[model samples]
Target chain A: MRVHELETPAVLIDLDVMERNLARMAEYCRRHGLALRPHTKTHKIPELAHRQMASGASGITVAKLGEAEVMIQAGLTDVLIAYPIVGREKAARLAALAERASLTVALDSEEAVRDISRSAQERGVRLGLLVELDIGFRRCGVQRPDEAVALARLIHDLPNVDFRGVMFYPGHFMAPEPERRQLLEDANTRLRRFYDAFERAGLSIGVVSGGSTPTAFISHEFLGVTEIRPGMYIFNDRTMVGLGVARPEDCALSILVTVVSTSVSGRAIVDGGSKTFSTDRYRAGDGRGFGLVCEDPEAEVEALSEEHGHLDISRSSRRYRVGERLRIIPNHVCTVMNLHDEVYGIRGDQVEAVWRVAARGRVR
Target chain B: MRVHELETPAVLIDLDVMERNLARMAEYCRRHGLALRPHTKTHKIPELAHRQMASGASGITVAKLGEAEVMIQAGLTDVLIAYPIVGREKAARLAALAERASLTVALDSEEAVRDISRSAQERGVRLGLLVELDIGFRRCGVQRPDEAVALARLIHDLPNVDFRGVMFYPGHFMAPEPERRQLLEDANTRLRRFYDAFERAGLSIGVVSGGSTPTAFISHEFLGVTEIRPGMYIFNDRTMVGLGVARPEDCALSILVTVVSTSVSGRAIVDGGSKTFSTDRYRAGDGRGFGLVCEDPEAEVEALSEEHGHLDISRSSRRYRVGERLRIIPNHVCTVMNLHDEVYGIRGDQVEAVWRVAARGRVR
Candidate 1:
């Protein structure tokens, strides 16, 4: 099928651009002597994960065990769940996956560690553990260095769990250009304190994993970081462009939508809305609307309802008639991918392949 | 399975509360002498739609053709797609659905009518058309009464399409108490002008359909309205409560999540985030947090990442530890339902049944 022949509000991925993005990230990691562990939460497609591994990614990172299970079932042997897993059900599932794969998980609480340890022991499998450090994003991770060391010690003392290393995320460092460089430096300075604390306690931190798309290129500035796990690098979005991480043309993913309604004076409605493009705003507050209109740059997506994307075309030089097709580079590609069932891999005007978003809605 | 035994970040619907909500709306429509066409976009479950139809609903309304197809496949013979659908793919699909079901579509453009007319002619099926009027939503629909009459005439002259009536959505009338009443009155006054124009043009408006959850009860005050299409009445949310339409206790849908991390100082993280509960905020901007914490009302969900819901527990008397379960009444239940795959129907503490969100991710 051709790109224009697909139905409206369909997710389209430029295969050439996506391959270039994968190769660029892999080459960057090789040059920096770092292991690339691309996060699978971005696309949630096992085919994409296999492509990443073929392009030289050491392993893959997942946000949940549900996503990890999908990747593992697709024969991706090395997996890292970068979130805290609690409760008996999740712990048992994680331990079961470890029996046939190199499974590792991150945690910050002793209760979670104990549950995982028991599950691993019952399954007679060894599991790797990484103590999560709160580098700046206050959403998760242990705040104090002492607390992280305590959790590391607890993991070492467990029956089947080993203290692998530590992990941190600098989600607040998404700034433009030189300013972002300074923010990454500041975040790295704070991360070094925890690294030193763990070293002073005679703990061997073999794997110091941390990296987001915003700081993917400059990750080497963070001392003691051995690996990078950037998800959105595969399909950069408007947020990434606004943060100076990627150029507008480098954005590989876009929603192919049509102008469904143009009766309103200044606004036109597209078929894609919050359900397809999502309501996740840009972090920099760039005020670049919901996304960038590839066909008409001046047209802005002012707001979105459940199934309607309101495009403000008052400033555009060209007028869009009803039924005309347009492509939109969403503000955040990860959430947009999660909302769709299948995505078309396109090269130029033709669709190369169709891949199911196998792990979509796997939020468990 | 018991409620406690279910997985975290799960959507749970209280059967008793849901039944009560359905009964109240059905009785209201009966007393007002209006047909109730409940919108299935709220729950997107066939079982729930069957319950509504059994409770005296005339039919069901959907936002997309994909949803209409799902309902038709489940044996629903009557469905109205309340959106402007363009493109050849959608027109063909809509015509095909019209063959098996009493399908009606709302549109405001001549091009759309011609496309649907051609598809209906190709399939040898008659489609019911509604001239969509912009009742101040500014999202879609014709702007003026003359424009609506022109489209109605076009529909009347089409090959296999019949001009059924007019449709309007008072989306901008969401407010609290006396203010909401006044807004609804102001909107109705505008709607009366359009109805008068259509009547003067010798067009028989068989079905004047309009209603939103915020103004569902007061829809009878609008003189020309013959039917009400309320979607959120099935599963009310914080937005409905803020609009003074439904009380907090009236919300039937709630997300059951477990506290995954409490190591952070004044906050704790839950297993659900934008992926589970969605990024839709409260419309009133009442600073009510993402959703109301049912167990600890004082606990505010200050921030949300992709996989973590950060709860501010400074004002709460209760201290939430890791693995502690809590229920959250989402700000918008419709979008929340679209995010999950399955919802549990619960009676008290026991799970009565588990129903798949049959029409979820149907954003074509």
Candidate 2:
């Protein structure tokens, strides 16, 4: 089927561009001697994860246990839960997953370590553990190098847990080249402190995993990092374009919407809104609109209600009519992917495949 | 099962509070001599819509045609899709739905009217139509009162279409009482223009629909409104609390999440983030946090990544540990509901039932 024949508010993936993205990332990692473990949190599709593995990914990384379960059900053997596993229920789920796959988890707290260790011990499974460090992005992870070493030593000594290495998210350095390079260097210096402390403590930290979509290309500059987990590189977004990491054409995903109302003088309303594109601000850009209108550079999704994408067409010379279809590039693709159940993979105007976002809303 | 036993990042709806909310709105609309058509876009659950209907709602309102389909399949006979139906595909879908249900749609443009009319005629179904007016919320609708009258006359003259009336959304008047009253009166005066124009045009204008959660109680002040559509009243959110329309105790919906990391001195990370709670800003409140932590008044979800909710516990005297569960009242309940598959309806600590968010991602 043709793309234009599909329903409005449908998410479309340019298969050619996506394949290019997959090959480019794989080639980059291969040349750099870095293991690529693409995070499935962005796409949340088992088919895409399988394709990533086929394209040279060592394993898959997921944010939640439910997502890991979905991927494992699709026959993925090597998996990593990159987020901390807390509580007995989640620990038990993680341990059950470990029974089927070569499982690894990253955590920063001793409490998380105890929870997962107890479940792993009960299930007779050895789980690979990575200590998470808050190099600069202070959302999660241990704040100090001493804290990382303490967690590493504790994980190494724990039964049924193998001390894998360390993981950190450099999500804050999405600025231009010079500034981003400086921030990565600063973070790399701080990351070396944890590695140096582990060496002094006579520990072998085998896997140093750290990378984000913006910093994936500069992984070689990340000091002793052995692997990278970049999720959004598969189908880049407006944020990636704003960060200068990807071009507008590199964004493989776009939300197709039909203009529903054009009665308001300067504004046109589309069928998709915050529920379709989400209210994620374009903080990486000028922080003005919700998404970029692919049809017109001057037009932007100025605002959104639950089901209305308010397009500000005041600056655009072209007038929008009701029933006119337009494609929008959302500011954040991950959240948009989670909002939908399926996405269409297209080559030109032809629909090549329809992939279910199988793990969508698997927030547990 | 108990609420605490449920997995982390689960959406919870307090049945007791929700029932009370239903009763209160029913009573208020009864006393005001107005029909209450609660918008189902907030919960997106068929059971909740049934409960609202049982509580004296005239019908259920939805934001999209797909949502209308979900409600119709659940045996709902009356539905008003309070969104424009553009394109032949959506018009055809709406026409098919009208065959089974008493369907009404709101539109503001001639193109929309033509599209829906063509499909309704083809399907041999009479679809009710309402001319949407822009009553200060510059989202969707005709900007002028004359435009509304013109659309109403056009609909009245069209075949296979019944001109219901006019629908306006006063969504921007969510301030404190005095300020909100003033704004409502201002909108009322503006709304009078459309009714007077209709009267001059010899239009009956039977069903005048208008209202939002923040302006539902004061909907009587909307000069000629006969029915009100309030979506978020049943599951009041932090935004309603910030607007002073609903108290914190009145909020029926919340997200249950576990503290996954507290290694940082003043920040604690929870399992739910933008994917769980959404990136909707608390625009009605101080706009400082993503959501309000119900345990401590001072603590707030300061930020969010894709899978991590960063809690700012710096102002509070509470010490958070890993595996600790926290309930968060999201800033906007509608978007949060769209993020989950099922919500646990609870009575105190006990989980009463689980309802699928039937129209969760029906953004089309």
Candidate 3:
């Protein structure tokens, strides 16, 4: 069925466009001699993971175990879990995952290495681990080279865990006119220093990984980085747009919403709301709630009830009446895609196929 | 199985307590002489809806057409959609739903009345409509009594649409206690006046519905209201707690999460993140995020990533450590329950059943 006939608030992804988008990134990675490991957390579709593998990606990176499991089951063998598996439950799960494929998990602590090793040895599987050194985005990962060396040493000494490489994400460095050279040099120094420390301690550093979508453009100049994991580049978003990584049309996914009401002369309401766009409002210089345009630049999703999207439309946008549709490129595409069960592959106006969001509600 | 044996970041409901909660609400409505029309949007489980009906509820209220369809398929004969459905796609679905069961829809405009009438005319059954009046939420519904009268007139004049009654929400009025009486009075008076206008215009004003867990406490005082549509009273949350509506123990739903990590002697991380507690972080007063401490009242869910819940514990909660299980009462139970596909029913510490959240993603 066509997208319009399907329903409002449904996720539409043009398969032909998505493939081109996927192929475009794949081509870029190949041209740059970079091993492409697209993050599966962006789409969470096992089919997309398989497609990415077929398009010549060296491996795939998943944010959560639930995503890793889905991709592994779909026959995309090489998987990198780019998050710390800290708890006993997850450690045990990661051990099982390691047995299924060439699994590499990121760790930022000696305790994590010990806990993961306990599970890995029990399962008779060796887990390849990366020391996540922080370049920016101070969420997870070891901050200092000394901490990285200690964690790497611990992983290297573990019974069933191997220290593959050191990873760092210069997420905050993804500037539009990226301070490309300085950021790359900084990342190289941090990673190489950490990697060298492990080597000095009589350890082999095999993999060096980092960089997200915004910083992906300068992947060739990555210092001491053997590989990069750039996920959002597959389906660019307003976040990418704001970072000047990709243009609006480059985004493969969009929420196709129909005008649900137009009773008020100049005010029209769409069928999508917080349940669709979510509460991730990106002001990106001057955009309103999420990616929606409003009269005032500082437009918050000003007000969102459960089912209604209260957009304070600009005067020109208000002129657009009921029954029309608008394509909303979300600030964070991953979160928006996670909210739906399926996304349509749209070729122009034709809905080529509906792909099941196989990993939906896989929040573990 | 024990609750701890289950995966981290899972939805949990105390079945015994939920049954008790249902009976309590049903009993209160009965004693107060009001027809209980529980909004199924909170739970969206047919089993719960059936239990609600069995416990003396007159009917179920759904927020979307997909929800109504699911309820009808589950043998719920009478359902009221508390959302304004306006498009051809949804209108057609609503008409088809009317053919399956006794359906009532909320409408706030003459255009919506025309659309519903058109859809109803296509089907053999007449559409039951409730004129929604604005009671200060200022989100949807007609502003004044006369505007509601105009819509009522439109519905009454239509051949296939029946003007059922007046429906409005005093959701904003549900502010603990001091302002609730005044808000309730003001909203009910406006609604009753519209009901009178409908009556004077010879239109049937069968149901006068209003809602909220906070205001539902004083529902007995709302004599003109025909039915009450309180949703979250079953799974009382932080919002209810903040409004002084219900105490902590009264909450039936909670997220069962495992502590995944601990940062030295400082912060502890859980598997429950935005995906589990959901990204619905509306701080009531000064609370940082969307959940309350299940064990310690002073602690609140401070931050959440897509897959990590960063709970900021007070200095008193220092005893909480890694590998321990904690129950979290979400800030908004309706949104949290909607985020998951299933919820485990627990009795004491044993997981008795795993109920699929069948109508979980019917946000359309």
Best by DockQ: 2
TM-score of each: 0.98, 0.98, 0.91
Which residue pairs come into collision in candidate 2?
A: none
Pairs that collide, model 3: A14-A346, A289-A301
Ranking by DockQ: 2, 1, 3
Clashes of each: 0, 0, 2
Cα lDDT of model 3 by residue, A241-359, tens digit: 77677776687888776665544343556677666776664525555456644233333345555677665553443354455677667778777777788888778778887888888
- Enumerate the candidates' DockQ scores in order: 0.85, 0.88, 0.40
| Pairs of residues at least 3 apart in sequence or in different chains that clash in candidate 1 | none
**Where does candidate 2 stray beyond 4 Å?**
B176-178
- Over the stretch B89-155, how does candidate 3's per-residue lDDT look in tens digits? 6788889988889999987766667878888888767888998877766666777667777888788
Candidate 1 structure quality by residue, lDDT tens digits, A1-364? 8988888789999988899999999999999999999999999999999999999999999999999999999999999999999999999999989987999898889989999999999999999999998877776889887888889998988899999998888777776677776776767777888988898998989898999898899888888899999999999999999887899989999999989999999898999899998888776565657998999988999898999999999988888899999999999999998899999999999999999999999999
Model 1 over residues B1-364: C-alpha lDDT tens digits? Answer: 9999998889999999999999999999999999999999999999899999999999999999999989989988899999987877799999999989999999989989999999999999999999898877788889888888899999988799999998988887766677776776777787888888888999889998999898899889887889989999998998888777889889999999999999878899999998988888788757457888999888998777889998999888897899989999988899899988899999999999999998999998
In angstroms, give how far residue A305 of model 2 lies from its true place: 0.9
